[model samples]
Target chain A: MEPRPTAVRPPIHLRIADDIRMQIERGELPPGAAIPTLAEISERWSCGMNSARGAVALLRAQGLITSGRGKAPVVRIPPRRVIRSSERHQIEKDLALKPEAERGAIGEAETNLNMSIGAQRFSSQYDQVEAGPELAKVFGVEPTTLMLRRQWEATDPNTELRLSWSVSHIPLDIVKSNPALLDPNNEPWPGGTQHQLSTVGVEIMKMVDEVTARMPTTVEAQLWGLPEGVPLIFCRRISIDGDGRVIETSDADYPADRTELHFVTPLRPWPKRRQA
Target chain B: MEPRPTAVRPPIHLRIADDIRMQIERGELPPGAAIPTLAEISERWSCGMNSARGAVALLRAQGLITSGRGKAPVVRIPPRRVIRSSERHQIEKDLALKPEAERGAIGEAETNLNMSIGAQRFSSQYDQVEAGPELAKVFGVEPTTLMLRRQWEATDPNTELRLSWSVSHIPLDIVKSNPALLDPNNEPWPGGTQHQLSTVGVEIMKMVDEVTARMPTTVEAQLWGLPEGVPLIFCRRISIDGDGRVIETSDADYPADRTELHFVTPLRPWPKRRQA
Candidate 1:
């Protein structure tokens, strides 16, 4: 069906921006290619310089292009994506049962960032807080129960930007059995959290991952050095043990421009076909 | 951590915007609450109206607030999320083998939106195109192979916005045995694509879902009636048959403002502990 004739045309600046955006999307203006100069855009589109400037600003804000102060803008070159797959859940559980030596060689850092733990700047901070209503519901505990919160981060030494960030919450009663788990210095935590839980005789049998995305706050943008238009993907992982107890909930953020969350589902075959 | 005193201060407008963002994040300024008017903000911050306006624009750009021309701004109230889980792959495969009567009850509309197919303004358009290099790799076919492309949409009549949208591609040679598969009218096809493929002797044994997100184009925003700062989540589902040949690839988009992608991973228990 034809669009309504009464539909309003977009403002001049938006029209110019959308045209450039399409060029970028179609790869006519390839990644790292400089955007046309303001004069050229104004000449071609028959618009004022301010309109041309607005178009560029819109492109930058949408994260389709990048520029430094006083620098010419160019289409952004997408970052190489790092796959973070749901299959890692089983891998981590298997690592938990390995001897410490083998587990030591395959730390969380290696699996997540494909970098050795010793080569990156990693930090872990531990604290405890009363389980509020939200936490209580997830843990099936009283609101007064103390929950241990562990915030973990891995930063790129050269860029000083976070390579990974996640915070985990577990009812203190569940892990207090192992005092070693309470110490921050014990991390890089070989075999990571799964091993830590194994020491307390808790086994994780299920991990449910909930994923969503949102634009980052200004502070977050600065921290990640995110270009405009990029969204941050947030994943909340809930770990449940065989006894149907919620063991831990960890939330992590990934810059959407450079991350792919892959989930593989293998289906069961149908019952043997009846007489043909 | 305490030694970095050389950081530059953010601009006044940015600082104000960050403060309001923090309030919203902390739930102090709950969703749907009105943002302070420009006059009030200028008075409180001792800044000019232009500065206050800048702050509000930043908030809207970040998708934390919603405003209309000549209307006061308010914190954005998120829509109710509809979860699309990975477990549905198994469910769909199971449904493909059920009796036609049973399959009739569980159409794609019922599963994704919890709305009956009859309630939606649904559309399907079938076309054919040569497999491009990118799609060729996915389907493991020659670049010149003809592929049937089906675009499907379900719109909410009241909003006139799409409730669901997806495009699927399958090698024409694979499904040509069933001419009905190439016809658009056959859809809302009983049982969906899985059942359609079953008619051609294909059984999907695995599905790999790759998920990412990005800011929507202006056209997308207008079509979805999305407020500023909302991101669109994109999921590519690759369906592989029992012989390991990729049978179909479908790409779907969901607005992050009201959608959640969930993946459930069930882990196997570790080998039993050896004698201590």
Candidate 2:
């Protein structure tokens, strides 16, 4: 199909930005390589200094390059992405029954993080609070019902940057009998929440993860040490018991630049009647 | 646990912004309601006009409110999110076996879009291209291998705004036998790619979705008419055949403000020996 002509061409700044973007995608401008200076860009594109500056600003907003005071713009060095897979849910369940000696050798943190466990600072806080309206609706409980809230955080020991953080909530009535379940010191549990639930004779048969993304608040950005244009991925995982009751919900955030969530799904065979 | 006292308090602008955010979250300031004017905010917070302006800017950067050149800022009205669940892979496979009349009633676009099918304009473009280095590596094929690329888009007819878009690729050697598979006119093909591949004796048994996010470029923002601070969610779906070969790959983008991806995993029960 022939292309339709437009009334006006794209602005000079956009053309320059697009050209630079193509170079980056082609690997001609690799990561950590400084971009062309403003003078060079203006001469090459035959545009003014303002156009060259606009082009640089456009690239920064798209997260393709980084610019700071007294520094040349460089292709952004993308962070190493850690893959978080849904397959771990079943693995954790199976490990819950393993011998303590073998299970103790492997913690979920060690499996998920690239750094040594000793280099990270971990904290857990547990409290009993009334179920708020949002959580109460999910749990199908009264608004004033007691719920156990657990907050966990792992930070880099030297830089104090947040490595991982999450909050988990469970109905207090379900796990009250298991005193170990309410203790924060019991964290780094061998098999994670699945094993904790098993102690109460509750088994999680299904896990649902709902994923979304948003710009982080000012405080959150400060805590995560996020870059200027990055967003945060928000994931809420809900566990369901065998009898179809919602047992627990955990909410976590991952910096969008350095995390990838992988989900594997197996499909049923197509019916023979429609086989061509 | 009590929070320890800090050496210094947060800036006045942050306090003002936090208070307004609390009001929005508490429903005291509903969506689309005009935020306090600069004069009003200054008086209420006992701060200068610049501080009040800074507070509003903070809210805009966090995507909590909207501010334009001359208009007062208002609480952002969130778009309605459409949930796309991983379960649809099986649902599509099941639909492939149904009769044409029943299958025509549902399309992939209808399942993912918020608008009626009749109100949207759908287009599909088919082309033959060489598998590039990145794609060739994924397919474990030679770089010169011919691949069929299909671009699909659904747009609002009246506004020409993009509703949904995706690009899919399959090795041409695998599907060249069925001429119908290479034609764009054959789209709206009942049951989508799953059914089309079924005709070629290729059954997709497993699907892997890799999810990440980043800021959109200028062209994308213009096409989607997105607000100032929204990000784009990137998802790559890889389909594996019965032989465990990656057969098809599709790349999709969704506006972070109005899309939720849901994945459901059913875990296998522990061995009988471990069942307590």
Candidate 3:
């Protein structure tokens, strides 16, 4: 549908912003390259300084450019993304059945980062907490039921910037017998969570990842050191056992600008294929 | 780590906004209920009117409340999410082998929406377009090569709200002989794009979904009727044939607030059980 006639002539700032955006998309303006100065924009668009400033503000809000109080705006240098693939679910499970020494040789996060393990700092904390109302409903348990909460993080040692952060919850009754599982020291737990559950005789048959996104809260933005316009990708993964019981749930947040979630679905083959 | 003392004291407005947000999360302030009036907020928080107004503005920017000029602000009512599961890939492929009458009973969008077919309006437009540089790289074809573009939209018949919107592209040479495939009139086609490709000699072996998110442009937000803080989920699904050729790629967008993307990953069985 055609836009309203009155809106056809967009405000001068938007027109200016769109021109620069087009230039950026077409590669005339590459990442980390300085954007046109206000004076330059004003002259090119035949507009006032305020209009030029507004154009820059628009680009900043859309995450296309970055500018400090006095620094000139530049095309945003997109962060390198670490692809998190669904295939890892199987790979982790397969490693769970192997010998402990073999499993310890590879950490899931290390494989995901495709980096040397020494470059990152990892930490894990385990505690017992009451299942809150929201998680209680998901597990079909009482609100005050004991649940094991585990927090894990991997950070760049030098910068201390978070590379990964996630929290996991499991019913205490399910893993209390395995002393190793109760202690945070057992983590980097050879084979990850899938293997941890294996010790308690619970085999995770399927995993469902529910994905969504939202703007980070002020504190979260500060913690992650996120850029102005970036959003946080939220994922809640529920692992189901063979008996259809919810074995564990993990909540993770990834910086949207540098994370890509890849899901691969294998289609069933056609039977007695017919060709036209 | 504890926040610095100076940074610890957030402005009064943030504190007020957090209190209201907690109330919403705790279910004391239900969706669609009018938020406290400015006077009530000012009195209860022992703050000035400007602080109260600022609190309300913060909530609106976070997408927690909606306010019109004269009408009172109300807690935003989140829409019921329609879960789109990756499991449907195999299901659609399975249905393609069924009889025409049986295949006719099920439409891909109808199954995904879990709604009666009569409630939504579906449309499809088909046209031949040049494979632009971006898509050409994906398909390993020349930029000027002919590609068939199909755009589909399903909307609520009464509300005219979009239920689903997607665009699919495939090289014309892949299915040129199947004239029915090129016609938009044949859409809502018994089994879906996967089935249509079955008419020719192509069988989709795997589907890869690359997911990301971004704030929609002004035009996109208006088209989707999205609220201020709701981001759009962008998914690009690439279909690969048995020979590992990229056969088709479909791009779809879902509103973050009301749409949840579920990906189910089934892990391979352990070779042999190892007792801890």
Candidate 4:
């Protein structure tokens, strides 16, 4: 027979938090529903006020609820998700060969956020820096090699919060032939990064996306307006040439609570009759 | 002009945590080094013991340090990362056509964990369940559509901790033609899922991986042996046949601190000489 509960227990605060979390998960406390008060929790669990406070804190830290000093905690209403699909890689490459008029009509900012660049302020800054040890290793370049680093950001003017941000780095030798590529003023750069490379007679044949996640630091949270418990999705995208040479690398961050990173893989078909 | 610090303080504990977090980032306090004690923190920050305790708790929750009742908290030494790459999708598809002897020689456990299946305990549980509204929508089937649900997991025998875990779902009608597909006893199937689907005349020509992340629940944290601050990377992989029909959907989670998801997208080459 299975042993009964109450013999061994986790910390009182953890138990209390778990109970509340279950209620939230089960829809007993639906989104926007208020969490129980401290007094009510203490009474329900027969725990001290300290345990009750800790339970609430835990819930907030877990991103299950939203609370402020003057407001009662409520179940967090999930934000609308934004899907970033790998298919865009092909689309961007295709755009590079499209008519200039067609290429100028589309911008990643619009496709990514469903908001036009006109609705948000866009900025691009470029500078040259030594690749240093880590970046040089990634680019297979010497530590003394200079690289052109470009930072791009789209921000909501009203909130002064970033809607999208990324940094791209390329070895100076690779793109120095195209002066436009080194100038920030030339961006929006109709056709995006692929076109920029195309202008320099470079053709990207492959891209690799490396993804991971981690909790946001306090400054990151404040900047992103993130609630507690949300993690940031980080992706480093490496664009490669036909010769398998790494040409450029770009890194970006997305709020996991509202981002869905989609990767699509197309597999080669098996030989006829192989299925049998 | 930027304002100076000390004018706007974000809680004493937050300040303390930020200081230590910076130290960790800068490698001032290398991994495995002891964190400052409550007494030291309090003295340095000129804060009370409660604030000091809160700062330490915050660091632990951020997954920057590890501590237990009797042991001093120390900067966490990151675990060895295991990479799960999308390239494996095509590898599995190719393996489905290989000779039985070669296919049988390889198991996912070996490829995924770099360990032989003989070194761990594996389990496969089969069950029949209604697709329900959510899953029905995903598969474009009725709510009551019978689905074959299979849970696969591998565990280290000594620690009883999970090495890998995933749940797969396939509409019963799609795989019922092959009875072996529904039987748990047929596991260790020669070429894994791709081959199993082949027996049912399902050819997965495409696969889409959807990934997100969040803090693991208290129970999940325990099962995964995750320290504080680590998040779980959740992936839902959907397999689509030639006609773009969804055949199988699988969900799995990986500890973010020790997992890297790699996605490779091969771009079509631009027209020759179009690079100019």
Candidate whose TM-score is highest: 1
* Model 2 TM-score, 2 decimals: 0.92
- Report the C-alpha lDDT of model 3 over A150-220, residue by residue, as the tens digit: 99888876655677889999999999999889988766788888888888888998889999988766556
Kindly list the per-residue Cα lDDT of model 4 for residues B1-276, writing each as its tens digit. 443344465899998999999999999999999989999999999999999999998888778899666788999999888999999999999998888888899887787884677998999999999998888988999999999999988888766677889999999999999898888998889999998888877889999999999988877887778887788899999999999899989999998998999999998877766623
What global local distance difference test value does model 1 have?
0.88
Candidate numbers, best DockQ first, in rank order: 4, 1, 2, 3
Lowest summed lDDT window (length 10), candidate 3 chain A = A1-10
Model 2, global lDDT: 0.88
Q: Over the stretch B1-276, how does candidate 3's per-residue lDDT look in tens digits?
A: 543344468789888988998898788999999989999999999999999998997787677888666899899999888888898888877877777888889877766774677888888899999999999999999999999999998887655667788999999999998999998888679878877888887889999998988776655666677887677888999999989899999999988888889998876666564554
The numbered model that scores best in DockQ is: 4
DockQ scores of the candidates: 0.67, 0.63, 0.55, 0.67
Instruction: Show where candidate 2 strays beyond 4 Å.
Output: A1-16, A38-54, A67-69, A271-276, B1-19, B41-54, B67-69
Model 4 alpha-carbon drift over 4 Å, by segment? A1-8, B1-9, B273-276
Error at A67, model 2, angstroms: 4.3
**Residue B170 error, candidate 4, Å:** 0.3
The segments of candidate 3 whose C-alpha lies over 4 angstroms from its true place after superposition are A1-19, A36-56, A114-116, A273-276, B1-16, B36-55, B114-116, B142-144, B156-161, B273-276
Kindly report which residue pairs in candidate 1 clash with one another.
A62-A229, A63-A228
